[model samples]
Target chain A: MDYSKMCPKFESAAELLGKKWTGLIIRVLMGGPKRFKDIKEQIPDMSDKMLTDRMKELESLGVVKRTVYPEMPVRIEYELTEKGRDLEEVTNSIQAWGEKWM
Target chain B: MDYSKMCPKFESAAELLGKKWTGLIIRVLMGGPKRFKDIKEQIPDMSDKMLTDRMKELESLGVVKRTVYPEMPVRIEYELTEKGRDLEEVTNSIQAWGEKWM
Candidate 1:
């Protein structure tokens, strides 16, 4: 995402997190660890396809992690990377701002 | 805009600023004041209709202000509102994060 062509920080920020399930997915993963089913349970409205797509995008951005376990059903879990963890502070501020104005 | 249903702050934040021209529009207005033409000049890729729509949306959100001067050659300029001004600090952090990461 070469955002230098654009001056707004929010443009790239939005592009990074603006996808349909991106933010909510991150918020869900913030809990620590979760499986595909667990994430789907957390967001009942999200389609399986969209959730999968978002996970791939976050993983590519180095903001999320995916772990697989050999099991009867082939269990897998998702977690936030260190870079993603830092977003807690920023997102907290965003929450404060949202509650204040909106 | 009612984001209480979502724990992810970025969801709401993205929704508020994630639209096509939303972020770039805010970034451009950060300079101080600009007219419709000035904004278009700043962002050559933006279409007139999109610019008009974005200005209306920002104005309604109380993030951008529109000042119009009645004259043969009408003069109009957009400035950031107090609420919008507060975003400067937040956006700078976003910029830093972007440069650090993607």
Candidate 2:
């Protein structure tokens, strides 16, 4: 196979998705928008610092949207954008593979 | 959502796939077994050492298999195991997503 002809977009996507803790964070958010604490609670093994970093990265990539709801106490939530929501297939496939193999 | 109920298998799978270059390497091998030089040539940005390390890691995880063929000159090849071939869905999904978004 002429791998040199491989798509650059797929390469970029692979690099982005393959980052440490990024996939898990995205998977957690796939449930719906949640507060910072809530997201942290889901992936117990990940450090708060790591979660924060991944969240920021995802947000910057337009895969996640950070919203601050202002009331008496501001409620900040992280939700997937349309682009991120499109990743459901990717994550779900991983989950399926993991169940069978991992 | 009860984040505590998240599947550990999924988490482990995410971590493994999310490793840098692992996804790309798997995608390359998806074509078929290839020589080390062929694989390296496909992904220009990756260093030789990094590719070696990732290959070893994937082999250890049972995702990749290394075989040596005896001939006039030694022939070595790397190929995906059943487990690795199963990741086509995961990689294809990522490719689809990348085509649409990235």
Candidate 3:
């Protein structure tokens, strides 16, 4: 991440947000809190392992939160935190730029 | 590349711009055109091979242009195209977010 000697902070952010599938995972979660199944549904091809890894990474970074509820059946959901929501500008810009160019 | 299944354009753009070292390379070039040595000076650890490969990829995608001059020194430089420059917004936003959060 420190490969970018110009700006270590920016490089760190790029490493987190710029990894393949990371941005899209955040984009999907941005829709709202969702169950694991729902997230998997939206990203049909993502392996369970990959999804779990990304979620754990995001969660550890304080960008995403995971909630567990007691019920007849165990329930879990993922949603963006306030800090994560701040990335809206980044996501929107990327989407807009992609739509225009790609 | 289309792992998102949400917006292919955005996914494509992310794949191109979000890869390791790609964003920083563009960030450095945004300052203006520079020779291979200059770019290397800014990003010290990047191997010559990696820099060459990224430059070739960006050049092929029309985001970067490589100019050759028939001078005594055989001058060569890399610069962002209009399309590439448009990414300034993306770079700036990431930098801002990084400085604030990271």
Model number with the top lDDT:
2
Best by DockQ: 2
Model 2 over residues B2-94: C-alpha lDDT tens digits? 334577889899989988888889999998898899888788889999999999999999999999999869999999999999999998899
Error of 1 at A59 (Å): 1.4
TM-score of chain B of 1: 0.82
Chain B of candidate 2 achieves a TM-score of 0.92
- Which tens-of-lDDT digit does each residue in A11-98 have in candidate 2? 8999899888888888888889888888778778889888888888899999999999897798899999999999999989999999
Chain A fold similarity by TM-score, each prediction: 0.81, 0.91, 0.91
Q: Judged by TM-score relative to the true structure, which candidate is superior, 2 or 3?
A: 2
lDDT of 1 by residue, A15-98 (tens): 686566676776677777888888887688889998888889889889988999999879888899988876665555555666
Stretches of candidate 2 above 4 Å error? A1-4, B1-4
| RMSD (Cα, Å) of model 3 | 3.4
lDDT tens readout by residue for model 3, A1-102: 232347988878988998778887878877888888888887787899999999999999999999999886989999999988888878887887888777
Order the candidate numbers by DockQ, best to worst: 2, 3, 1
The best candidate by TM-score is 2
Compute the interface RMSD for candidate 2: 2.8
Candidate order by TM-score, decreasing, is: 2, 3, 1
Retained true contacts (fraction), each candidate:
0.21, 0.73, 0.65
* Worst 10 contiguous positions by lDDT, candidate 3 chain B: B1-10
lDDT score for candidate 2 against the true structure: 0.88
**Lowest-scoring 10 consecutive residues by lDDT in candidate 2 chain A?**
A1-10
Candidate 1: where are CA atoms >4 Å away? A1-11, B1-5, B8-11
The DockQ of predicted model 1 stands at 0.34
